[model samples]
Target: MKYKTFALSALALAASSAALAQSSTGSVTLYGVADANVQVLDGASSLTRVQSGGLNGSRFGLRGTEDLGSGLRAFFVLESGINLDNGSNGQNSFWGRQAYVGLATPYGKVSLGRQYGSLYNLSSDFSQFSNNSFGASTAVIGGFGGYEPVRGGDGSAATNGGPTRINNSIKFESQNYSGFSAGALWGAGEVAGDTKGNRVADIYGRYTQGGFDAMLSYVDDKANTVGLKTRTVSGAASYSFGPYKVNGGVISVNDRSIANADGEGYWLGGSYALGQHTFKTQYVESKNKGGLVDGKTQAFGVGYQYDLSKRTALYSSLTQFKNDGNGYVARAASSLPANLTSASDRDVTEFVAGIRHSF
Candidate 1:
């Protein structure tokens, strides 16, 4: 397999910013992705738009590691999202995407800061679409479909599909043993008066051997805003044979109180690579099992990618959202397909052609 990554050194930036300890044993690197696309979004009306991140999100980040002592290292990362279409920041926070520092030992690694929840990390691998705004089920399942920019923000609890990134969190992951490993996280509730305010946590275990991979995950969300409690459990798997690879997963969100609704979603996707070109297809469907929420969203997408080089690629995809059942809008977690139409049951179509470069 051949892939590309773009990374810059931090020595230059460090030279001007701070004095480096002559004895310090560590290094820093800067890296990011630049991706942009043109799309036709057909919502209530037809709209043409230029977008960023079709296959992958664009963002720049700084990461560093320092040798602390015998078999120990201190590490940190500061990452931000980018929107090339408008030249705007991706995440709301300056380093909204990720800002964390941790220690790595022979046995495991532990860190504290804003970080990805267990479920999100687990889903990224098994997911064929990976919650892409356009081609992924994660978009509709977790409300990532542009309708909510802050799906995991404070005050919003248990309403999301996949357990998203967490803020003010502590996490631990055991060193990989063979082809299996485990990890857990605890996001602290920062409210002074309330101990459990905005607190969340998750745990997951994964195994991979040869071309087969699988995972089991659990999420516990306890938000103080409305005292809403959300619990989730999921299982997923994937396999690859020759030029073809297949992936699938099932997720269930248990939130039967406030909204009196429990959400469930399933997705399956497959791809085949022939030389420099790869073809893709996927389907995602989600619904709330109870409460007044009586709508579900189903999406189907197909795309092609042509490798321009090891560092860049040109790609295109066409996706449709069937806002069937009740009155669900055609949307993704990060980007909406077209826009929502006046009729809740209307279908939305999306097509994108784009170029992506990594550095």
Candidate 2:
């Protein structure tokens, strides 16, 4: 009887040890975001859209990490975009926005799959909208410019492909060093028999210390549709003093295929918080060089938000855009337009008011 009891105890101990080992080795997490809004566009005519992912892109994702031990980890992320309005899949892909597997260690992380470029991440980090919001001017100022035509064969704006995201990418992010971090990404063109010239590369670095922050980025793409290689460089800084934060940045783009096609731009933005109310404003300008015509444009916007609860808020924004030179016009691609000239000339003004909730 004593021998049987001892053997049973030993078996239990072994099982417990195996369970602990498995638990220490890996974990998986499920996370998601949902955002929707009813919006109106004015300018040339009145139009309305029930939009999903207003404040944030709606998405659901699974993320996992396995400890390889010795401070090294194997990780993966598979995220799918979702349309909250109709409870449908966004982009109709299982892992549309982000699908990557990589390794992480004290050195940093190396990931391979569809992902954003380093320049995109750096600019987004410093922008007030961070590539969201109806008032975001990143696309208008040519800061995020690329070769993909805005309109398709039907002359309507194309949705499937654009500059905002990238595919077939391998990226590396360096571990933070003294409050500074850097990253680089390369997108494979995957063209058979030719690999060198048909790709994109981007690099970015940033420093943050105390209440001050700064960033810089550069991107180059040769496979763009116009057969023109494009290069962009941008930098910005921000400071926080008490209840207010002020930030600004400058961006420049060069297009080799289009004559007079170089462009430079700058932005200044700030926000102030007072009790339950926050006020924000920004101004942006861009100038084109050696293009068909010297194009120039400017934009100004202001916004306010009131917190209703920890997870809910009410917000409103007013913005306007002005353009000059031949073929220069501003169009409200994201929100309601404000004036008739903008409607006829492709210029735009917009206002947005909405409520947002998060969990």
Candidate 3:
């Protein structure tokens, strides 16, 4: 009887040790964002359907990391988009937004699978609107033009190269040095031969010190579906002085399929806070040089927000776009139809009021 009791105790100890070992080496986390709003267009005949992520898209995701020791670790992320209004998938894919697995260490991090290109990542930080918010109109205004239809597939803009979220890609991010860091990415065509020319490549770098930050990035693609062969170069900077912050950036796009289709764009934006109220404004412009036509478009926006609490806020914004010469086609307005008549020429405007919460 004494021998049997000792044996059972020893087994229990061994099992507990194994479980603790596993817990120390790996971990998984679940996280997400939920956002919704009511939107109306000025030109529309009547108030239209309501939606979410109007200021920001809704999403959920799973992420995990495993310590491999010696400063090395394995990590993976799977994120999915969701429509909060109907409780349905946003892009109709399990991991349509981002799906990646990679390894990281003190030197830097290298990731594989699907991910955002260096150019998009860099540009997003400078804009007032990001993801699905009011700033999303930038895509149509040529702020960061490329193949944009693959991920959203709304036919509102040209497809940049692959999906905004790339596939079969390898990305490398460098460690910060003196408040500066850099990164590069390459997406494989997965075709038999001719790997270099048929694929995509991007490089970017940024610096941040004190209240000032700036970044530059470039992307090149030889043969992306949609016959999209493009090169984009962009940079942005911002500074905070007192209770106000100022930001600005420029982006240039060169497309192979269209003659003189190269374009350059810039934006100037700022924000100020007084007690519980915050005010913001932005001015953006785009011009096309060698395309079938020559023209320029400009957009102006203003917004105000009142924080009701740490996690909730109410906000309102209004934006307008004006086209000059042949540039009417390049205007960015939420009121414009997803499918515009090629022959029509007109200005655009959008206004939105909503509430946002973060948990």
Clash pairs, candidate 2, are 41-336, 42-337, 43-337, 259-290, 260-289, 260-290, 260-291, 330-346, 330-347, 342-347
Off by over 4 Å in 3: 1-5, 44-47, 85-88, 131-137, 140-163, 258-260, 325-335, 338-345
**Model 3 accuracy (lDDT, Cα):** 0.67
Candidate 2 lDDT, 1-359, residue by residue in tens? 99999999999999999989987899999877766767655555556567666556678889999999898999999988777768877645657767889999899999987776654555466666554545644445532323111110110112212134556778899999999999888877666765545566778898999999999888776654435466777788889999999888887777666453677877788889998888888887767766665767677878788888776777777777676777655433243334545434655667767666665
- What is candidate 1's lDDT per residue for 212-325, written digit by digit as tens? 999998877776554456788888899999999999988887873476567788889999999999998888887767766567777888889999898799998888877765
Q: Which ten residues in a row have the lowest lDDT in candidate 1?
A: 153-162
Candidate 2's C-alpha runs over 4 A off are 1-17, 85-92, 142-164, 224-226, 258-260, 333-345
Error of 1 at 55 (Å): 1.3
Best-fitting candidate, measured by TM-score?
1
Look at candidate 3 and give me any clashing residue pairs.
Answer: 53-56, 55-133, 129-135, 146-160, 147-159, 147-160, 148-159, 148-160, 260-290, 260-291
| Every model's TM-score | 0.86, 0.83, 0.85
Question: Which candidate model has the greater TM-score, 2 or 3?
Answer: 3
- The local distance difference test score of each candidate is 0.73, 0.67, 0.67
Clashing residue pairs, candidate 1? 6-359, 139-333, 144-332, 144-333, 144-334, 145-332, 145-333
Better structure of 1 and 2 per lDDT:
1
